[model samples]
Target: MVADAIYSCLPDPKEISPVETAPDPEDYQFLAVGFWVDKGTADQKAREYMTKIRNKKIGVFGTLGAYPDSDHANTVRERVRELLKENDIMDLFLCQGKVDPELVKMMAETMKDDPHHSMTPERRARLKEAEKHPDEDDLKNAQKVFEQIMVSLNN
Candidate 1:
């Protein structure tokens, strides 16, 4: 949904490709990549694509299970910034996204005996809170941010 919102805001002569099948970075003047954070970092495919890009105007947008303004989110943002430090990054936007309930249940069951397991009660509650996200407001914000990115790209 976040990617969809960003896609809607893109100008003409744009091409959309999955991170897993990334195009050559030099082929485009500007590149906007959308991804979801997994295990505290940008998705593996996104990381791979970022490594291949240099000297390009880049915009990154993504979703994560943590609250958008949380320390965890900030860390993820910084990680992405580090990956793109050699490039001209236009902007980065992140927001809460729904967690996979089945994955959460599996983790809970598998770590039931580990008192210090990562999935604590508070973490579960935060995941629950994530379920309502990537909502209308998130989509709107993504569109707005991407529009601004386009404006910057043009200038």
Candidate 2:
């Protein structure tokens, strides 16, 4: 969805696609980076790439099961911005994405008899809260952010 939004705003989006692996800085004037939030910041792959970048224009975006303006999201954004301090961080956007209840359950399962995954009341409640995510509003907000990034890039 983020990609589609960026492409929609670009004059020739078909000819442009974001790089998955770290890209050569000389190849593009602008870059749109998207990632899934892991822990308190970007996933490992994204962190690696962001750290490698220097003196380039970058837009960072991510999706997680938290509100766009939530404390968790804010911390993640701060961490990401720090990584891009040496570069020109054009913008950033965060939005909730569907966090499957099953996936959460499985993750908890992996914790396997651990105190946090023991089907405890607290854990169950947390799971329930997490289950309510990635709704329509999140997608719409993310798309809007992507469009804004495109506009920022153009300027």
Of the candidates shown, which would achieve the greatest lDDT relative to the real structure?
1
Q: Looking at model 2, which ten-residue stretch has the lowest summed lDDT?
A: 13-22
> How much is the lDDT of residue 86 in candidate 1?
87
User: What TM-score against the true fold does each predicted structure earn?
Assistant: 0.91, 0.72
Estimate the lDDT of model 2. Answer: 0.70
**Which segments of candidate 1 are over 4 A away from where they belong?**
113-121
Residue pairs in collision within model 1: none
For residue 47, model 2's alpha carbon misses the true position, in angstroms, by 1.2
Angstrom error at residue 92, model 1:
0.6
lDDT of 2 by residue, 54-155 (tens): 888776777776667777788888898997899888778786665676877787678767864466766565556656655556556666766777776667
**Candidate 1 lDDT (Cα, 0 to 1):** 0.87
Against the reference, the lDDT scores of all candidates come to: 0.87, 0.70
